[model samples]
Target: MAKISLDEMNPAMKSKQEQLLGKFEKESKTRQFDHYLLAQGLYWISIIVALYHFGTSFIGYPATHLHRSLHVAMILFMTFFLYPANKKASRKSIPWYDIVLAIASLAVAAYVWIEYINFINRMGSPNTMDVVMGTILILVVLEASRRISGWPLVILSLIFLLYGLFGRNLPGIFMHRGYDWKALVNHIFINTEGIYGTSVDVAASYIFLFIMFGTVMNKCGMGRFFNDLALAFAGSSKGGPAKVAVIASGFLGSINGSAVANVVTTGAFTIPLMKKTGYSNEFSGAVESSASVGGQLLPPIMGAAAFIMAEMLGVKYSSIVVSAAIPALLYYLGILVQVQLRASKLNLEGLPKDQLPKLKDVMRERGHLLIPIAFLLYMLLFSGATVIFSAFWAIVATIAVSMARKTTRMSIRQILDAFSEGTRAVVSVAVACAVVGIIIGVVSLTGFGLNMANAIIQLGQSNLMLTLFLTMITCMILGMGLPSIPAYLITATMAAPALVKLGIPPLAAHMFVFYFAMFANITPPVALASFAAAGLSGGDPMKTGIQSVKLSLAGFIVPYMFIYNSALLLIDVTPLVALRVAITAILGVLLIGMATEGYLFKDMVWPVRIAAFLGALLLISANVVQDIIGFSLAVLVVLFQFYWKHKKQIA
Candidate 1:
């Protein structure tokens, strides 16, 4: 709420910002070549990649194999040049061996593109040269994934690769007819089912453009505008800075789609303000982590996974957005309620009105920045445009709309910078998508997906609730230390089918898996988003993760609610049923927040907290009988809290 100028920002805050951005950005840790000529060449390579994607998005892409191969090739080439093999490697130079690998990546990609027709003609059979190329490509993809996304995904991919090759020797349901090394490599590398599969295709076509759109918007100052708008709207309310974090981070994260990165970018500004306004370090970190993670659940551009989800389910992207709307709302509602309850419990006050920006003035200065987003939504939801078309137009609209205001307009150089940044930003996601394709490749090759689904179903003893529980656990485990895109992909490919086998609708099943996959960002043990927030807030990482889980309880629960009663997802339900589910779900989230924070009208006793928790769960159940019971319990708790507050006031 305090409008501090750039000069007034302290050294500590600046240092925190740099540390967080470096850690989350991934590319920042890459070796920066000291040779000016080499660095300039690398920069041009990134720009060229961006230009390639930009041109393809409008003019039509090449064959899936050709397009995806080129996309991955460019990503790999840049990645090797930028990211050293290890942290101990010199930061100011790329090792010579890495340069060789980079060249190898390009040669392999060129092979795929040049021989696309030849490879297709060969069908399922591959030559020795094909096998060799495929093997190298597989290694390239795995290493790229490891460098960009960390080891979790790479390790997971390796496990799947080993499984594919040796499953016949394994025990029980996990066993399958084994694939030979050559067969495995060919399947995972040379074919469409492997690295060039749907996930990578989605990344190349839809996700890249959207990422570019987001980068363009950011370069044009959209992030600053969103922050200012949030401050203007919420800075005068109780827990103003915290509320601003929820709103602003949610806005930024929805577009950015990387929970850890989102936390650092928005938390850098909001966390300090929240602390200054009386929020605890851990609480401020948790709030930003929870809110930023929720952005992946937000509509229009709900992370890279959403595009993959659309591709997997063969549904319109708009459908996923529509179904996701209510759950995303409830997730944030839970966070907001907890923040507000905490503020009241501590008697925290908002910043002085004079220190806050005026809403009208903020809007007048930067209101046009919102038009591109509005145009994007209109194209997606109303015009029924394809996701790629929507995003392409959105990018154009972003650049054009920026021109309306000199203060916000991006010059030609800035536009090029936006393109380069956008391309660089997507390297992690693209590599992850390519690597996960190997998992999917193996799953399809060895029937591992179906086998795993059956095994889960058997472990649950055919009980739907038990199956859902096991799937949740699996999702959380797989999602650990991984980004949401690959996490969701792995879970959706493996666990989601089990839920579908249990008679859950496909969309609901995938959405259920998707939510839990993303919830990992706030779950303990390896909560990336939470840790990033902790860095910004200067809080204990473990405590921040725990607090994040507590604040985001609704996200963990809403997936099950919608799975149980599809009306919550607006599926197979009347308007009345939809309304009832929506209302109950929102109220349930608020109750959960009160119970988690141990405050409502006043501080609650243990018994009241237990009752509130149970009631919240019941409300989310969406059963008429459960709803009645939950409502009665909630009402009783409210009455007691109200009376207790009154008595304390009198005292």
Candidate 2:
């Protein structure tokens, strides 16, 4: 109900936000220069890089190798100067060695462009100069990835590289005729299939543009508009604070696509409000984290991973958007219903309606911001525009629309700052994509993806359910501590193939792994989003993570449901069947909420909770008989609760 602004937040809360972000988000742990010369240099360099990508969106990409090489070069140069070598390193100025590395980065990237024709001709048999340049590029990328992406990815990439070079010494399905250093370097550097492969290609092509679009929108005040709009609509209902967290986080997630960032940004405002409304600290943190993680599943942007999926699957990005809509809704719906029920159980009341902004007034002031989003979706789904074309225009539209309201207009300085900030934001992701490209390259060279798929299939022994469980575990494990793009890339390479082999449709299989990879941010043992929320809420991280898992129960199940019946994905199904499936799935998720919350009309008994849980599973499954049985069971529980309430009143 209150006006929200970061500038107005308490100093203690602001410090906590910074600490939590630094601890949980690797990308946020960067050196901020206080020296004017260093700061100005970094700013202009970032602006130049951003301008280059912006120009490409209009002028079109260059040759594949040239484009990707330049992309990696720019990212590495910035990364070396921006991120310190370690926690103890100086922040105010760049180190001399890092400067040297930055300059070397240009040389590594420029060699391909300088020797373009020669490089192409020597792809299989590289000369001495090619090998030297390739080796330097590989080392620079690894070091840059380590600095920006953290150690887990660096370790994983190194392991894959080692396997590529030394697989002959291994046993069983792992064995391969190991290639020498020159051959491996040439494959990864000279050829497109290795470091310059699809992952980096998508990063250079689509992800950077969308990142800029999100930044421009944020600079023009869309973030505040989303918070206000969500508050206007949901801030006065029962359990409204938690509902606001879910709604606002979902809206922000579509733009930012980073769970920890989303949690830290929105949770700073919403978590304290939820706690004030009688929600437990852990519950408040869990609510924010769960809702934030679900944002990656939200269509339109879906964290940039959707674009990569489109690239991988050879389908329109709009198709991923369409298939993702229902499931994403189900996830948020589950959180919303559970929070509402919890509020009822605890007798928590919403904020006063008079204290809330009127929906009309809020829309009148900032509703124009919605135009770019709507236009972007229309172009993607109906207008048949390319993703790059749609994204570029969307950025332009955001800048144009901001002028409609003087309050939201972007000044030249603000525009330059957005470009600088957006380009800085992309460094970590671009590095991760480049590092993951090594893994993809290794898989291609060693047939490791097929081998891993066979290993999983053989281990599961053709039982689809068991195999799905194994794949889910693999995805969650791989996804922990990794951003969703590379997480999806890794799992899609290693685990999705196993599902496809088990007769799961390719889309459903990839979606299955994608869901789990995203969920790892809220799963226990390594829940970065939940930990960030906990820091903001002053709750226990492990408890917050566990509670988040309970809140996100439906997310864990919906993937399997879609795998069992592609109708959930709107694949190979008629409209009538899809509508029916949607209704039952909604009901199932609601029951899951009721079961997990332990309340329906009144506090549910253990037997009733168990029944609700079972009914939820049945209804979620794709079977007519199961749906009927599940619906009947739900009705009986509702009737029983009413009867119990009446008897208690009589007593």
Candidate 3:
């Protein structure tokens, strides 16, 4: 593969970095937009729209003719000038095909604006050009989305679009009066029911602004601050570097919204440190994979999927974050506990304090920048500010806070660059979400969603476990090739009905699908996160991916737990019961950890391993009888281990 030095990045990434660096900037890695980085920007754009859509999303932004005209002009400018001219830009020049497509898309958006304005001027059926333009717009958006992101989303969208036209041809239990060109176009364009639906709206509003918030925060050194903070706190412990990577990766992932970036940033430091500390190449890679994958589930940002959930659920983003607090905390706890156990078992110590940045000093320098995050939450809960508004001002706060100190001030150029880059970032995600809307629109129009739900229920024959297993398999397969947010979007639209039919709550059903989608990152044979870590670790990529699945065992089990014990997700938590659920869940996690690790009070014998396995399974299920059996087995294993340890000590 062609390579560039750390100092010599491609023009686009360099532009992005410079954009982020603001006024008072130090040295930076000049990264280029290799194919991989181009792809990374595609993923990051998915996040950007969500940020862009922030303020206008809730307060109501009209598609005024003036705004539409301006919007089209800007899209054209961005595609032709801004995108093509950047030094680190992909391909060094826009591909002729993309240029043509970009121009065509501008024409379509402009046509839509004109037609909508005409419609407002006169009440009439859609004209031939309007219908044609609308259909072309769908095709163009889906095509652009595919060029940038991948074909999976495009294929899925096309299937749904086809279904809209052919639903009546489907067999019984899977049929509807299919839509036609005019109807489909009207639905997709004139109304906010298809392309410009909730997905795009969310992306263009709250999600985009929040992403800008992240971009600004990055300028102020959130990533570095997080890394230094992690090093200060965890670098002195057993396997400290890996823990630091995990902690730092999670923080970065929550903000950056790309696993590849997370790995490259933190993995460079942690992978070598892990190897130097005696962690096997595969294990170290697995650790990083697990950590990066787990980061999205962490909150304030909680991945793009969180905002999508709020949109799908028709709730404020705050509610999702509040509800997610416990589950996200538990997820981090599970990873931390596993890491600590592994370190203890192997006697891995931390990096020297002298080598680590001092925690106090690092915080002292950058603590003010944290105000935006705090302000964001306050705006969400107390101020009743819509997520978009909160995010816009949060961006303002990020810039303002950074400038409070001379070291972090952002110049006008830097702030505007952040805005421009932030808008560009949303292009892929916006396109992807727009295309995925085809799937949703098709499912909703054709009744395929309901039929599929019916089909799943029939296949399970009322057996919940079988139903869940099938759903899990489906989610993993879908997620393997697609980004989790889009994967979750499709799954929630199509597969969620199955569980809802089986009497699962809407939230539970969605969360179940979300977990499996995230787990796909570690599940071989297409574990991208694992592959990235493996590249750095010099380990067998496949082995690292497989080991990652094992190390991230909770990814498999946690979904099941929440399905059975909804309290795990705060589904019906009375204070007293919530406390009990938390306790049992922790024990359940420990039991499962011991079963998987094959150790307890002492190294477990094979027979005791069997008992621990049962114990873990039983408690993880969280039924009263199973809990009793689990406790009995777990206590017996611990007692046996204690006795055996004392005997060994005496010897």
Residue-wise C-alpha lDDT for candidate 1, range 523-545, written one tens digit per residue: 88888899989998889999999
List model 3 lDDT by residue over 33-127, tens digit each. Answer: 45666556543543443333444554666664333333333333243322332234454334666557667767876665666668545323577
Q: Which stretches of candidate 3 lie over 4 Å from their true place?
A: 1-60, 64-90, 95-97, 117-125
Per-residue CA lDDT of model 2 for 1-651, tens digit only, reads: 455443455788878888888888777888789998889989999999999998888889899899999999999999999989888889877889999999988897788889998888888999999888888888888888887767888888889999999999999987988988887887888888888998898888788988899899999988888887887888889988899999999988977878999999889988988998899999999999999999999987898878889889998887898898898899899999999999999999987787777789888888999999999989888998888888888988999999998889999999999999999888888888888988888898889999999999988998898899999999999998887788999999999999888788888989999999999999989999998999999999999999999999989988988887789999978999999999999989999999999998899999999999999999867889999999999998888888887886767
lDDT of candidates 1 onward, in order: 0.86, 0.89, 0.69
Clashes of 3: 28
TM-score of each: 0.97, 0.98, 0.86
* Candidate that scores best on lDDT: 2
Model 2 has how many clashing residue pairs?
0
RMSD to the true structure for each prediction, in A, is 1.6, 1.3, 6.3
| Cand. 1 Cα-lDDT | 0.86
**The 10-residue segment with the lowest total lDDT in model 3:** 22-31
* Order of candidate numbers by lDDT, starting with the best: 2, 1, 3
